[model samples]
Target: MSSIEIHQFMCRKDNFGVLVHDREHGTTLSIDAPEEAPILSALQEKGWGLDYILTTHHHGDHVEANEALKARFGAEIIGPGREQDRIPGLDRPVVGDEHLILGEVLVETIDTPGHTIGEISYHMPLAQAVFTADALFSLGCGRLFEGTPQMLWDSLKRLRELPDETMLYCGHEYTATNARCALTIDPDNLLLRERATEVEHLRAAGKPTLPVRLGQEKKTNPFLRADDPDIAKAMGMEGADPVEVFAAMRKRRDSF
Candidate 1:
């Protein structure tokens, strides 16, 4: 079986760094550099050299190490076309539905404009994985930075249409915190309760609780389960549309 190797690094406070290695093609892709030192350190630890830099958006937390990494690695920078000017070190601007090969894996871009106006999530159908930066978290989604509830809602719906078995790698280590908020929106949900317990234990042990499956997210994550009846009632907004419930939940989390 052919599969890409994924290395998730803790780059900055509450931030992430991912390195995808395609052994068959001898190329490596780093997703969203948060800081220079940690990413370089992680690469050195893995003994991997970067070939490409994939930027999901223009957020500083996501792209602060772009310039330095590109300078050091001499790698091409791929960015969302909507905000190429904002995304530093963007060498290649691509739009939604574009297909490109990095090593042996083929990556397809899916525009998910909610956390940022130009946010784009990567879908690797061949590998059955995705690099969802800040758009969809484990138990929640990102704060609506430059888009609307409708925009974010639609963006997640699009991601949901991917293969149910898709492996999700979000941009931050916010699952435990997000899962806490998820309980407020899905108090009696058995899946949420179980997921919370698992996440809590892992975090208590100082372990990572990420790379949640899409199928699991559909069942337990309140942000992804906005249409579920239990989630609606728990949010104190039964009989409401999914978007309405999601918006209210987001508002509550923003204050929490």
Candidate 2:
């Protein structure tokens, strides 16, 4: 069993600030530095000192508090090697497909560009979780800001290859909106409908609807199901390439 404990909280409007703690090793790390105050509060509450910051991208909202947290906790920042120059106080630059051991836990970085040209996702197999910062969301994927639809689609495909039981921890709390858009594309999906209702209730209760299972996302998230014939048909593009279907869905979501 995994001994790692994960604490997730909202930061800077919709961005999520996450802390991954290994109790046995007394190692505590954060996913991204969305803000400094809340992160510090969380660390204090948990009585854990920050040891590392695992950055998924170089976006301002994601890395805005990098230097502040580093200065306060002396945490080492590890980020995408491809965008190392963009991230502040980056001590370790890692590329996709590279494996590193931190606090006795193996961390695998998966290149998930499309949200940004150099975005990456951190996957911890033993912990059964993947932090897909901006590359993928619950029922939607990030906007293609610096990459092509093909690039985003390919990145999502790689993420889909993870174990079905793996939990997905995304960068933002956009499930409610994404769920609404997902139903429009896959209206006939019974699972999607159920998930949409669930999302609505979660938001109404002001609860986080994240850490969703990859298996559930694969069945309900339209972006991940772009290749499904039913989804393609729903979009009026039957037998279309998965990338084309994915592109159409992303474009529609952009305006949604």
Candidate 3:
């Protein structure tokens, strides 16, 4: 088995687009098409051809370039099974827990519905990585646009169960703001304070803060820390259900 190669780049305003390649078989996959120009540029820069498009949801910003890319590369599109009608150029619709083999890698989808109905995150066990799209971020998760906080919480818990070293490739560059908000709620966290400083330095250098390790997020991301005693105490929800703590954190982030 060979390793999976990943290329992460900026697209649109704040969106981050990703490309995954299985070197052994030359199988190239794109997580979402936030835009056409950048994705095309990435492909050109890497001299890699796109073979598949795996979408997380039906948001316009995420799928707007699906048709154009498919037309250009003859790529097969796979996405949320329930939203095939909305996902332009969808060739295969997949629900949660389905597996797709890409060369030496196994791509699995987990249902993540808090950000949007039928949203999913792709986990490649061989690569120890998950393309979370808008469902989960470095130090934050997406808003509750189509589902409740509890739904998002459950979805996040699933991701949290992945190995600590799992790399998280999120959809946007929102870590700076997420870090600030995380500090407000988790002020006593030394790890979070250190991470906030590191995030500031990364953004100051105009670098990407993504592909964050799941273990680091467990320590610094307030949303992921709902079960931690320190976070629960800070939120004044000590002993409360993690779902309730998660809901309160989401509300705070929304207003922050």
Candidate 4:
């Protein structure tokens, strides 16, 4: 480990962004910006200069502030290759499986195209963190907006193969609401039940319930545990493949 620093900032109440600052490498990478005001205020209040803006997808809330921040800080804008037209001022359009270098940190971009046509998640080996934008949330996942449900399910499966310690960081503060939805499907799930309790406490105390570990997610998040028998059974399918089970769970969550 190179002592990477992760700062989670709650911008605009619901919208969230992350700043990964590596002091040893002297580089700071800013995740998607739902709005420019929060990004600018964060940079000023925390005395951080935005070096790069990594957008997960082309949604307005995700990339709406892309152009403004890039012009102000001259930061490199990295967007998924599938959305050149949707994302603004894309300095680098990366495809899936491309390795992105951020100073001493190497971030592997995982193309997660279910939420949007060009959605991608950033993975860092050293930090054991994944910025999963809208593709996957704490207890739920993003809706199938562009790609098929199968595409999103496959993307999440690939991410699940990572080390159990990998930390998940999403684009929004939807943990509390997501946990509530997960309970409907897997109420007896020990991990989910415990997490709901914990999340409630965090929310009441006005704290962030993100950067959850991969091991923890596997135990609770139905979207990530499609292979689990309980999840498949809840989906009303016997021996249903992970993709089918995941799709049903996503559909339920969408309506939840």
Candidate 5:
């Protein structure tokens, strides 16, 4: 199998655009088009040409540049099967649990429909990475905009099941705010407190806090802690259903 290289950069305010390159095949794909300028710039900077655009969901910010990039590079576009109509320039549509061969790399699509009913995350086991779009974020999860809290919670569970070492590349740079909100709910958690401090320091230094290890998120992300007895107890929802606890946390985060 060919080794894969990943590049992550800021695009359109807080959104993050990721590029995945299969070195052996000399093929490069963008995780989401995000915005044309930055995506184009990144490709130029790397001396790579875009061959494909993989869309995770139907949100405007995520797919807004799909057509432009495809036009500019003549790249084939692959996106969620359920929302193919919503994504621009979709050449191949995929649903959950599908395997796609991009160069020598195997891209496994996991259907995580919560942020949007057709949200998908791309997992590359060989690369030890997952591009979680808006379904999961660093220290946080996407808001319940189109799906129920239970659906979103279940989606997060799928991601949490990945190997602890899997590096998470999420959609946005919202870790600082997520850290603040998480601290309010898990103040007694030593790791959570420490992670919050570290996140602040990284942001202050103008560095990206993303591509975090799933192991670290499991230890500190509040959304992923709904099932923890301590967190449930701290929220006064002890012995309640984890989904209920998750719902409560989501509500609090909404207002937070």
Candidate 6:
């Protein structure tokens, strides 16, 4: 059986640029185009040509290098159909709850609108990985830039349904800050405390705190635990609707 390889690197200060490759089919694609320089560098270092660009949203920071990379590598650009007009050089607009195949790998498109109205996440069950972009993060989630709190909470619920073993690849490197905020919300959570300590050490060591397992996030990420009774109790909102608790948490996080 052939294996898949992922190249994750930092771009544009805190954004992440990821390249997913299928060794069996000699197919390689990028998750997002944060910057041309870093994307080009990572591709060159891997000695692989880019075949496709899977865009998660229309944010400038994420799609700025779309045209450049496409022109350079003649790669196909796929993005959210709802925001096709916003994404530059979008060759294929994909909607949520759709599936496509790249080589022998199956790619599942999940609707995750919150930070952006048309944001989507890419999940590859075969690879046991999902690229969540700004919709979901290690210990937090994206701010409500273009969507509502309800929209974001709904989107997160969909993500939480993903298998426990799935690895989450988000668009930014804000885990350390998120950890601090998470502790404020769930101070008595031993797992969260330990994870926060781990995040601190990782950031201190100049290491990336990404590709966190979904199982870990389910237990530690406050945003994902909005429906948990314990989470609601911690927020002094016992029996409150999950969405209400989630909104309160998001509001607190905004200022945290």
Better of 1 and 5 by TM-score: 5
Lowest lDDT sum, 10 consecutive residues, model 3, at 97-106
> Mind giving the per-residue lDDT tens digits that candidate 6 earns over 103-153?
777899999998999999999998899999999999999999999989999
User: Candidate 2 — worst ten consecutive residues by lDDT sum?
Assistant: 98-107
Better of 3 and 6 by TM-score: 6
Top candidate when judged by TM-score against the true structure? 2
lDDT of 1 by residue, 167-187 (tens): 899999999889888887777
- lDDT tens digits by residue: candidate 3, 91-210: 999999989885556899999889998898999988889999988998889999999988899899889999998999999999999988898899878988998999999999999998
Which tens-of-lDDT digit does each residue in 1-256 have in candidate 5? 4378999999999999999998878999899988999998999999999898889999999999999988888999999989998999999999989999886778999988878998999999999999999999888899888888889999899999999999999999999988888888999889888888999999999999989999999999989989999889989998999999999988887886
Model 4, 57-155: lDDT tens digits are 888888878889888888899988889888888889898899878667788999888888778899999898999989889998898877888889888
Which of candidates 4 and 5 reaches a greater lDDT?
A: 5
TM-scores for all candidates: the values are 0.96, 0.99, 0.97, 0.95, 0.97, 0.98
C-alpha lDDT values of all predictions: 0.88, 0.93, 0.90, 0.85, 0.91, 0.94
Name the runs in model 6 displaced over 4 angstroms.
none
Error at 232, model 3, angstroms: 1.8
Which lDDT tens digits does candidate 2 get at residues 28-108? Answer: 989999999899899999999999999999999999999999998899999999899999999999989999899887899
The reply for model 1, stretches above 4 Å from the true place, is none
- The lDDT ranking, best first, is 6, 2, 5, 3, 1, 4
Clash tally for model 3? 0
Once fitted onto the true fold, the runs of candidate 3 whose alpha carbons sit more than 4 angstroms away are none
> Residue 106 deviation, candidate 4, in Å?
1.0
Which of candidates 2 and 5 is the stronger one according to lDDT? 2
Ranking by TM-score: 2, 6, 5, 3, 1, 4
